[model samples]
Target: TQLLEQSPQFLSIQEGENLTVYCNSSSVFSSLQWYRQEPGEGPVLLVTVVTGGEVKKLKRLTFQFGDARKDSSLHITAAQTGDTGLYLCADLTTSGTYKYIFGTGTRLKVLA
Candidate 1:
């Protein structure tokens, strides 16, 4: 089984501040993804990184995949209250069943 580790399990910041979260694993994956979620709802996909060293941006958010494909990071610039939620990283495991494993998760609270 592949194990994923995420840093800074939680964050609380004022609007207009910035933060970064990370996900890492010992096993390499073919692709990696980031998601944002609100209470009582399923997570929404933010970005999928297929290539090592690839970076994708959406508004004030940026995502990056490690060169070894075993890690990823998400950076949020000038966060807004609307950005408060749960952030997650997911990757497919080598299990023949193709199981998807999610990271420990980062809970962000952006204060107004």
Candidate 2:
């Protein structure tokens, strides 16, 4: 079994400020998915980066995979005040036995 630990459990920044959230693990995995979860709602998958130097971007957010496939990061640029709720990262492995894990989650509060 493996665990995904997210850093900066809470974030508070101005609307124009930029920030980065990280989800790290000690064990390697197959794929890592980044999710954005709003209050009273299920997590929405932003992007998934397969093992290697793959990167995916959506609007103001960019997701990157570690070269070793054991870690991932999410960068938000020019964040807006409306960016509320929380963000979570999950990983899946398809070797030996299937495993799925979710990060502790990072709550973001963008101030106007």
Choose the strongest candidate by lDDT.
Answer: 1
lDDT of each residue in 1-112, candidate 2, tens digit only: 6789998899999899899999998688667888889888899888888857788889999888888888888999999976777999988865577776788999999998
| Model 2 TM | 0.91
Over the stretch 28-83, how does candidate 1's per-residue lDDT look in tens digits?
96679888999999999998889999999999999989899998999999999999
**Candidate 2 has which clashing residue pairs, if any?**
none
Off by over 4 Å in 2: 94-99
TM agreement with the true structure for every prediction: 0.96, 0.91
Prediction 1 global C-alpha lDDT: 0.91
**TM-score, candidate number 1:** 0.96
Per-candidate Cα lDDT values, in order, are 0.91, 0.86
Model 2 residue 99 distance off true place after TM-score fit, in angstroms: 4.7
Once fitted onto the true fold, the runs of candidate 1 whose alpha carbons sit more than 4 angstroms away are none
